[model samples]
Target: MTLFRQIYSLLFGLFLVVVMSLAYVQFTETQSFLSKQMESDLNNTSNSLGIMLVPDLEAGDIVGAETLINVIFEGGYYQQVKLTWLVDGKQQVWENDLKIDGVPQWFIDLGFFKTIKRESTITSGWIQLANLEITAHPGFGYHELWRSLTNAIIMISILFLIAIMLARFGLTWILKPLHDIAEHATDIAHRKFGPDMALPKTSELKSVVSAFNSMSHQLKQIFSSLDEEVSELRKKNLVDQVSALPNRQYMMGRLNSWLGEPNNGSLMMAKFDWLEDVHGKYGYQVRDETIRLLSEKMKEQLDEIAPSVIARIAAYEFAFLITSGEQEVCSKYLHTLIRTVNQEISKAGCKPNEQFYIGIAQRTDDMNVSQILAQTDNALQKAIADDKVFHWFESNEKQLYTREQWREHLSSAIKNKNFQFKWQPVYLTERDEIIQRELYCKLEIAGKEIHAGQFMPYVELLSLGSLLDRCLIETIADSGLLDRNHEPVAINLTFHSLSDKKFHEWLNHFLRNHRWAKRIVFDIPEAGVYSDPESCEALCHIIRDNGAHFGIDHFGRQFGSMAYLQTLRPSYVKLDQSFAFYDESEHSSELCRALVNVARGLDIQIIVTGIQEQPQLARFEPLKTNAYMGFIYPPEPVE
Candidate 1:
C-alpha cells in the first residue's frame, strides 16, 4: 500500500474506536438516568396513596379505598396498585399487564431496566389501616430509554461522518508535499534536475523536503560540471581556437562523409588572401579578432539558413557545407554568407570584400575526396590567378521538373503510401546482438526505388516534409511492421514535423490506438534539433507521452552546447557517420571517444554509424559504443 493510504487507514481506525467508545458511554448514562427517574416517581406515588387512604380506612369506607385505588391505577403509570385492610387482611387490588409502545421487545431484553415497586403503611390517628403498594411499569421507562439512546446514536453517527471527512482532507493536505518530493526524485533520475520544492509546514516532512532540495541542487551542479567538461574537451579537440569554427580534422572527416552521399549540398572553400597581409602589418590581436568576427558573421547567416556543416581547415582557408538540395536557395545563402564575412572583414579594418576568393564545388561525378578538393583548390587558384572574386567548378546537370511537378509527385506518393523502406539492425558489438533496427527509407515513383538523395532535395524544396514524415509513420503502423519484429523500429522525423501541432496530435492518436506503437522510435537530425531546441524538446515529450521513444541523429555533427542533451534526454543518439571511420587519426579517435563517453555518462545509448571496415568497427568496441550500424550490418527490405 502507498504511505498515504496506510496512514489514512490507521487514522480513520483510531477515530472509529473513539466514536464507538463515546457512543457506548452516552447510551449507558442515558439508561441509568431513566431508571432512577422511574424509581423516584413510584416511591412518591406509594407514599401519597397511603396517606390519602388512611382517612377511608378509619371511617370504615372500604368502597372509598377501592375507588381511590382504581383512580390511580387507571393512569397507566403503575403496573399494580393494592390496598389491604389491616384488621381482617382483606385486599383490594387493581393491576394491568406491562405493555410498551414505540420500543422493540429485543431492546427490553437487554435486561438493564428494573421493575421498581414500593409499599407504605396506611394509618389513622397513629394506627395502621392497611398497606399501600404501587409497582411502576418498566414499559414507560424502557420506551424513554430507547428514545434517549436513539437520539444519542443518530447524533453520534452524524458527528462520526463529519470527523472522517475532516481527517481525510487533512491527511491529503499534509501529504501533498510528499508527493512533490517523490516526483522531483524521479526527475533527478532522468537527469532533469529541476527547481527545488517548497518546504512543508509539518516538522518531519519539512526536514525531508529540505534535504531533497539540497540533494537536488548538488546533483544539478554535478551534472552541469560533467556536461561542461565533456563539451569543452570536444571543443578543444575539434574546434579552431581563434575562429571557434571546426578544425581541419573535423572538416576533412565531414567532407569525406558528405562526398560519399548523394546530392547533399555544395561545398564552398574560402581563401583569405588579405588576412596574411593584414597579420604582417597589424599585431596578433587584430588578426585573431578579425578571424573571430568573420566566423561570428558566418554563423549568424548560417543560422538563418537551413542546417549546415562549416569549419576552418587552415589559418587562411575555411570550408562550408550546405546540406540542402535546393540549388537556388543554396546559391543565395552562399553569396549572402560571403558578403557578410567580407563586410565583417572591412569592419575589422582588414580587407575589402572583393579581395577574398571563394571556390564552390558540387558532386557532379563520382570522385574521391582528393579529386574534389583538388578541383575546388584548382578553382580557388584560378580565381586568385585571374583576380576573380569567386568561381564554380564545371558541371553538367539539370533539374528534371519544376516546383509544381515535384510537389504533385510527392503529394501523390504520400497519399498513395508508395514508400520503399528497409530496416537496418544496430549491433551491440560485445554481444553481437541487435538491440533495434534503424529505418532507411526511399520513395517509390511508379516502380523504381529511389533513395532519399534522389528525391529528398525536391521534398525539402517543395516543403512536403511534414506530409512525408506523417505518411511514413502511418504506413508503417498500418502494415503491422512492428508486429512482425520484436526489435524496436526507429524512424527519422523531419524538421517540419518537429514544429507541427497537427502531426503531434495525430501521432498521439496513432500511438494510443496502435498496440505496437511502443516499438516505434522516432529520431531527428542533430542539426535540426539544435537549430530549434525548444520545439524539438516539445516533440520529444509528445512522442514519449504516447509510449513511443525518440533520439537524436548525427549527434556530434553540430559543434554546440551539450546542455540540451541533458535536458532533452533522448533514448539514444547516433554519432555522426564522420566519427566512425577515423582514418587512423588518434585525435579523431579520441574525439569520437569523448562524444561517446559524454553520451554514455548521461545514460543515453550511443550508436556509431558508417562502420564499414573491420578496423573501424573494432576501434569503437573498446570505447564501449552502445551499438553499431553500417554496410557491415546490411539492411533487410520491408515488404
Candidate 2:
C-alpha cells in the first residue's frame, strides 16, 4: 500500500477503538448504577409500606392490606409484589406477575440486572403483623440502559466520522509538499525543469525543496556552459573565418556522411585562378573582399536548394554540394551558379574570363572520395582550356527512366510490392555490440535495385510518397523480418506520410492489430522535424502510444535549436552523418563530447554515422556515444 493509504488506515483503526471503548465504558457504568438504585428504591418502599400496613393490620382491616398491595402491583414499577399475615394458622396473601416490555429480548437476556426483594415486619407497637415484601423488575432497567448506551454510541459515532474526515484532509494537506518534490524530481529525469517550488512551512520538507531547486539551477548552468563551448569550437574548426562558409575540413567531414548514403549529388568547385594576380596588384583587402563577395552571391542564387552546404576548400576555391539527382535540375543549378560567380567577380572589379573557371563532378556508386576530387580537377582543366565559365564531367551514363516512365515504374512497383529491405547495423559503443539496425528500402525495377535518393526526388515530385510508404509498410509487415526472434529494425517515415492523416489512421490500426510491430522503430529526418515540429511530435506520440518506438535521423544536421528534444523526446537520435568525420582533432573531440553530454543529460541515446577507419573508432569511443553506423557495416540485403 501507499504511504497515504497506510497512514489513513491507522487513523481509522484508532478512531474505531476509541469510539467502541467509550460506548462500552458508558454502558457498563449505567448498568451498575441502575442495579444499585433499584436496591435503594426497594429498601425505601419496604420501610414506608410496612408502616402503613401495620396500622391496617392492627385495626383488623385485612382488606385494606389487600387493596394497598393491588394498588402497588398496578403501578407497574414492580414485576411481583407479595403480602402475608402472620396470624394463628391463618394468612392473607397478595401476589402479582408481569413480563418486561419496550426492550429487546437479547438485551434483557444479557441478565445485567436480577430481581431484588425486601421484606419488612409490621406491628401496632413492637410486634410484626406480617412481612411486607416488594420485588423490582429488570424490564425498566434494561430499557433505560439500552437507550442510554445506543444514544451515547450514536453521538460518538458521528463525532468519529467527522474526526476521520478532518484527519484525512489535514494529512493530505501536510503531505502535499512531498508530492510536489517527487514530481519535480521526475521532471528533472525527463530533462524538464520547472519553476522552483514554494517553501513548505515544515522544516524537513523545506530543506528538501531547497536542495532540488539548487540542483536544477546548477544543472542548467552546466549544460548551458557546455553548449556554448561546443558551439564555439564548431565555429572555430568547421567555419571559414574569411567568407564564413564551411572550411575544407568541415566539407570533408560532410562528404564522408553524404557518400555513405545511397544517393548521389553534384559536387561543384568554384576557383579564382586570377586571385594571385589580383592579390599582388590590388593588395590583400581586395582579394579578401573578392572571396567574401563570391560566397554572398552564391547564397542568393542557390536560396531555393535546401539540405545542402557551401564550403571554402581553399583560400580562393569554394565547393557546393547540390543534393538534387535530376540531370535537368543539376544543369539548371550549374548554369545559374556560373552566372552568379561571374557577376560577383565583375562587381569586385575583376574580369570573370581573366582567370575564373568552375569544375563540376557527379558522384557515382563506383567512385570514392579521391576519384571524385580527381575528376573535378580534370573538369576544371577542361573549363580553363576551353575558355568556359564551367564544365560538367562526362560519365557516358544513360538515364534509366524518363519523366513519364518514372510514373509507370513507381506505380508498378507499388502495385507489385517490389520493395526490398536491407539492414544497416549500428554499433553500440558501451556494450561493444550491434543493438540497432536501420532498414533501408529500395525499389526493384526490371531486376535493377534503385536507392531511395535516386527515386525519392521523383516520389516527392509526383506526390506519391504516402502511397509508397503505405506499400513499403505492408510489405515489411508481411515479411518474416518482424518475427520475435529477429532483431528490431528502424524504418524511416516519409515527410508526406507524417503529414497525411490517412496514413496516420492506417498506421494506428495496423499497429493495434500487429503485436510484433513493437519491434519496429519509426524514424524521421531532422529536416522533416524542422518543417513541422508540432505535427512530427504528435506523430511520434502516436507511434510510442501504440508500443512502437520512434527516433530522429540525421540529427544536428540543421542549425536549429536542440530544445525540441525536451518535447519530442525520442528513443534515440542519430547524429548527422557529418559529425562522424572524426580526425583526432581537438574541435572534433569537443563536438563529440558536447553532443554526448547533451544527449546523456536528456537520457537519449546518440548514434554517429560515417566512421570509415578503424582508428576513427578509437577517436570516438572515449566520448562514449551509444552507437555508430558507417561504411564498416553498410546496408546489405536482409536474408
Candidate 3:
C-alpha cells in the first residue's frame, strides 16, 4: 500500500477504537443512573404509604383501609401501589383490583427492575399493622434512559464522523511536506550525474540534498580533470606531440559532423598515400624533411582561403571547409588550389608525382553536416575506385530539387498553418472493401502540394516531427470518423517522432482519452528502423504497449538490415516498389524467397508492392503475402 493510504488506515483505526469505547461507556452510565433513580423513588413512596395506612389498620375499618388504597391507586403516582391492614395482630392485605400504573407485561419482562420487598410494623395502640411489600418498576425510568441514550448515540455518531473527516484532513496536511520531499528525491534520482541539485526545506531532506549537491559537484570536477587528461592522451595517440591542431581521435567527429550538414560549399580532402612510400625509399631524416616541406607547401596554398577553417583531421588526411559563391565558383577554386599545390611541390624539388584522391559534395541545407561530408567521402571513394585525381562536387538534382526548397518552404508553411492531412483508403483484400483510410501530410505552397518526402527533413531539423504527429493525432480524433464502430485510421510518423520518449509518452496519454483505442495504426519506415535499432525496438514496444499496431513502409529497399525487422517485429512489412518489379532471373527470385522466409520466421505479415499484373499476384500469393499495393490498388498520383 502507498504511504498515504497506510497513514489514513492507522489514523482511522485509532478513531474507530476511541469511538467504540466512548459509546460503550455512555450506554452503561445511562442504564446504571436510571436504575438508581427508580429504586430511590420506589422506597420513598412505599414508606410514606405504610405510615398513612397504620391508623386505618388499628380502627379495624376495612372500608377505610380499602378507601385509602383506592385513593392512592387512583392517584397512580406510585408504580403498582398496594396497601395492607392489620387486625387482632393478624395481617390482612388491602389493594384495589383496578390496574394503577399501566405498564405492559412484555416491557416489564425486559427485566427493568429487581425490586427489594421491605416491611415495617405499623403501631396503633400497641398493635402491629400489616407489613408493606413495595416493588420498583424501572420501566418508565428505563424508557427515559433509552431515549437519552439514543440521543447520545446520534450525537456521538455525528462527532465520530466529524473527527474522522478532520483526522483525514489533518493527516493529509502533515504528510504533504513529506510527499514533496519524496517527489523531489525521485526526480533527482533520474537526473544524469552532472545535474544541478537544490535543497529541500525539511531538515532531513535538506541534509540529503546537500550531500547530493556536494557529490555531484565533486563528480563534475573529477570528470573535468579526467577529460583534460584524455585530451592530452588523444594528442599523444593521434597527433605529433608538437602540432596542436587535431589527433586522429578528432577525425571521426570532424568527418561525421561534416557529413551531417549540407550547404553550398566545397570540400577538399587530401590523402597522403605516397608519404610512407617515400619514407621507405629514403632515410628517416630525408623522409621527415620531405614531409615537413609538403606540409609547408600545403599550408601556403590553403592560406588563400584563410577565411575558411583548415584542420588536419587525421595523420595522412587534411580537410578544408571553404565557402564559395556558387557551384561553378567553388569548382574553379578547387581546381586552381590543386594546381597551385602541385606547382609548389615541384619547385621544392621533392617527389614530383605524389597521388591523392579528392571528392566533393556541393553543400545543401537539406542535410546535416555529417551527411554532406559522407557524400563528399562517397565521391572520393568513387574517384579512388575509378583511379581519378579528384571528383567534382555534384548535386543529386532531382532529389535535391524536391527537398532543398521545401525545407525552407515548410518552415513558413508551419507558421502559416499551411500543412493539412490527406486521407487515402486502405482496402481489406478479403472483404474487397475499404477497411480504413491513412492520413498523409500535404504541405501547400502557392497552389502546389508538397509531399512528406519534400518537407519531412525540415520537420526533423526543427525537432517538430512529434509536434506534427501530435497535430495529426488531434485532427483525426476531432474528425468524428473514430466515432464509427469499425473505422480505423493509419498515421505516419518520422524516426524522430517514434524515437522521442517524451513524444511517445504524450501520445500514450492522448490515446487513452481518445475513443479510437483499437483502430489506430502507425506507419514508419524500414530505413528509419535500421538507423537506430535499439530505439526502433523500444518505439515498437511502446506502440504495442498502447494497444496499437505498426506497419513498415519502403521495406526491402534498403536491403541489408533485416535484423531490426526480427527484433522490432512490426505487424506488417510493405515491400518497396523497386523490389516488386517483374524479373525471371534467379537473383531476383532468390531475394523474394529470402524475404518471405525471414518474415515468416518472425510471424510478420508481408505486403508486396507495384503489382500491375496477375503474374505478380501469383508470385506473392505462393509466398503467402498478406497484402499487395501499387496497381493492384493502383498507386495514387501526387496531387
Candidate 1: the clashing residue pairs are none
- By TM-score, how accurate is candidate 1? 0.83
* Best prediction by lDDT: 1
lDDT of 3 by residue, 304-343 (tens): 6432334566655666666323455556666766775567
Cα displacement (Å) at residue 244, model 2: 2.1
lDDT for every model?
Answer: 0.79, 0.78, 0.61
- Tens digit of per-residue lDDT, candidate 2, span 453-562: 67776787677888988888788878767873366788878778878888888888888888887888888888888888878887888888889888888886665566
What TM-score goes with each of the models? 0.83, 0.84, 0.44
lDDT of 2 at 58: 81
- CA RMSD per model (angstroms): 4.3, 4.1, 13.3
> Alpha carbon lDDT of residue 291, candidate 2?
76
Ranking by lDDT: 1, 2, 3
- Stretches of candidate 2 off by over 4 Å are 1-161, 200-207, 273-290, 293-297, 352-354, 365-367, 430-434, 451-453, 478-483, 505-514, 611-615, 630-639
Model 1 gets an lDDT of 0.79
* Best by the TM-score measure: 2
**Model 3 regions more than 4 Å off:** 1-30, 56-77, 84-133, 147-311, 315-359, 363-391, 394-512, 515-639
